[model samples]
Target chain A: MLRIILYSQWKWSRGWLLPVAVVGFAIPYFMLRVGYSGERYWDAAGLLEQVAAWGRGYPALAAAIGLLVGTSAWIHDHRGDHVYALVLPTPRWYYVLLRYTAGLVLLAPAMITVFLGALTATWFTTLPAGIYAYPIQLAARFMLATLLAYSLFFAIASGTQRAAGAVLTIVGIVVVTQLLAGIAGSDLNVLEAAFDRITIWPGPLEVFVGRWMLVDL
Target chain B: MPTMKLMLAIAFLLALPWRAMSGQAQDLAHVIDSLRERVSFWDSAAGYYDSITRADVDTVRVGGFAVITNGADLAAVEDAVNELRDRFIPIVGPDTILFQDKYFAVLGRGSHVVTEDIILAGLITDNITSQLHDAAQWYFGSETGRQFQSWLGPRVPITDSIAELPGIYEVIVLSPLTVVQRCHSGDIDACGASLALGLHQTPEEALRAWFNAADRRFLVGQLRPQWDYDLGRRADQTDGERRCIESESDADCVRILAGLYRSGMDVEAYAPGTNFHPSLPLDFATHSSLAAVALELGGDGAYSRLITSNALEPEARLEHAARASIDSVLRTWHAWVLRAAPPSVEVQPRSAWVTLFWVVVTAFLAAGSSRWR
Candidate 1:
């Protein structure tokens, strides 16, 4: 059953996996090279600016991998009307688990690539004092972010089109409510309050906040 | 056919001119020239404004004459001072009347000191002193003042007791002993007045006054019920440290005290002083005390407003802005600061190499696995 699941995931995503892996590995190495080369004459401020600008790429990579992997996971099933999956001699939960596990397994290589890239980047650079490189931590964060994106997208893809529409509608309602409150000139700091609630302590997205410093105190 | 060809040629020729005109209009050279002119104008204006604002503040700070009073009133007095050289000193005609605390101090040269003294003597006549003192006694003798006087009595004696403690000499040698002696002898109002005056005499006296003032202010500012406990603990720690010092180790005590003084001075150096004394304006130390007092009184709003209004002039604002911008740029300069791995002193190239090696190997294995399936 595991073999069948792996084969199916591979058949669906093989075209995208190679390019993404290469790009993932190259990102950290390229960033390090450019950053180090600029470090000689550039002051700490300039260097940090350049590094933060490049840091945006990590989230982008995670989201892309998630979206692509997720879309692929459902594409074949959708094309075949999901008839083959429903006919399988297993519970729907088992099928979903198998699919999720397979996608995670495939995601491991890209995660490894990020880790390698970060490690290599750290190895080559001469970090300033009071700073530490956390390649393992960076890799772990990248993995978690990727997994989160993948899981979210996978859940969306697995749902009926109506379910996806309902989720989008709820998001739209929240955004509209916030926008109206802003236009009404009420000191209704809904958006900022919502953002703080979501990004601060106890929020799922809290990990992304604070400092993303690869080398931090 | 020839007519059609001519029409097409004319249209093409007209289009060329239009495109050229648009290109010329959009030329970056013109934009750069305009930007340069605007920036130059702004830069000149900013510079002029900065200088004018600084000059205005300086003039305001030294507008009045500060008569140096070194009597009993000079004991433990804390006040801000601003200085001006003789050449730019404003002359209030000799016959002009000046009120204490109302007019700013203008320190003039010794050449005119005798003339200024004669003028000031006429202004602060005995009649005025007696009148002001009587007014103060009357007000302070009233129910409100009596209540305050009674409330103040216990606190003053406690302060005197603290000042008279044997180790007080280690902190402040002159004013504390004089103040304690004065207070112990039942000259309560005089003692209070002396302490206030001593703080204004010199920077050192001002600092000692400021230290005591800060502790008192801190205690008053704390809203928590446990603040007393916290303050007591802090006081105990300070007392313990003071008591631990051996009188025989005066040199060591001096060194330690000097270090502590330097730390306080350093903080003051970054702060702004008040405009009270003409000959010697408050130094960084005095300014820091004032800033601390402002903060203790009203929190960050008071502190920020005082510094912004009194200390941060146009020139200082520009300097601060430039510093902040540069600091921000430095913070983001390194991708190195973003590394997720715990850095070791020695670079570990092995982890990178191994990871890369395995990634390639895994990719190939994945590819091969797909082919087999």
Candidate 2:
């Protein structure tokens, strides 16, 4: 039953599996190629600032892969009104477990690809004197981020239509309020407030805010 | 006429390279002469042995590097500093160093010139001194560093500055022989320290005892800068800000610190932001006072009063915080043997193996997932 669930999830996500896996493999590898100049003057003031700026791409890629795979996990179930899921002879929680486990297992390939990519990226290159290549740490962080995003989007997609609508409404209200504040010459910036609320420490979205550095001092 | 003009132009072109080459030659010769002069001065001192100790036997707590000049061009000092830096920076991280060069004048009219006590003629700015103090801290307790045990066999252990010192010697006075021996063996900070042991002896006997490693009598007096920041003089000049005054060799600078502290100035107060340029505030006033105060308080349980007054302890005991602060100050003094010594650690590539191992383990785990479910 678990294997069947894994197979079903794989069938759904297979269309983009190759592309996402390739992207996962490429992210850290490309980051190293562009980031390190391996020169004496690499310590010039703004070099680190540039590398950190490029670091933003890692988490974004992880999040995108998570969103795509996670949303795919429940799209057919939502379309069928969860009829097939509810009618399963197994308990509802057991069914959810099977589905969650299957989705996570399907993600293993991309995670493995990232791990391999990170190892390959740092293997041949000599980083600046004090700096180190953290392939394991980087690949682990990417997997955690991917899991976090996948679980979040899965939770949203698995809910009833009304629940999805509620989240969309909240986001829409924030955008409209910010637009109105701009027109009224008021500094009541709802967009920035929402971003701060979501991205600061203790916020769920804070995980994405950390630096996804592959090579660091 | 055209042929003669061509010849003249060709001759002028050849002289241009020759002119530049001669200027380069002159600069090189001058640098060599400056080096020679220093060697000669030290060599002359070796032959003379006298038992007269100067009245001022006190040395700077952290041995100050004095660029001695006999009213000659001071530009040579810049070249010397560059030579020293080029020789050391490759061994240590740049951020871990505080290389501050101040041109202070010596005031006392002395015939012997065996010295350590130099007065900064003008006020010490919090901005630059704080930066120097921060660099001192990096030498002892920066990031996690590797312990030394390699083919090199017993490294100098510069990584942990405190660990490098012989126990008790970090705070207590040792025999003159030990201090002299340490100085002789290339300890730069040891140059002008050991007042308890060296001060009582005569300059000639003391120099012979330590093998002419350092002279505690010759004080460095810094002349104050003429530029007045408060008065807005030289504020816009490119090189005016950091130039320290040459010392005049007197009790005046120490007097100024005592005067400032006596006047109820917060000697350790946070510096004014407008007047300072560091990321954090530094106690410029206390730095001059630090050695003197610590030395005075270093005697048996004297720091207890400070600990009690500051509420660090119910009573001053030499057991913990009091001893710790003294040890810390003493560490600063020991480190002064030279201006900038790097505790170099050879770079290791342990991360590569760690990365490779993880890649294999994770790949194997993923492959086994088919059998697990």
Interface RMSD of each: 16.3, 14.6
Error of 1 at B84 (Å): 28
Question: Which predicted model would earn the best lDDT?
Answer: 2
Give the distance in Å from residue A207's predicted Cα in candidate 1 to where it truly belongs.
Answer: 2.9
Q: Kindly give the stretch of ten consecutive residues in candidate 1 chain A with the minimal lDDT sum.
A: A38-47
- Which segments of model 2 are wrong by more than 4 Å? A43-47, B1-373
Residue-level lDDT of model 2, residues B169-275, one tens digit each, is 21122122344345434453342333222231333343333322212111101112234679675333222112211233223333332333234433223132211
- lDDT (C-alpha, whole model) for all candidates: 0.44, 0.46
Model 2 residue B272 lDDT score: 27
Per-residue lDDT of candidate 2, residues A1-217 (tens digit): 9998889889888989888889878876667666655342212113344556766877887788778877787788767877787677866656666776788887788999988987897897766534567778777667766776776676666565666788899999999999999999998989998998766644455556665666654
- Candidate 1 residue lDDT tens string, B190-281: 33332232223444443344333322222222211122365554332333233323223333333333344444333222222321111111
TM-score of 2: 0.40
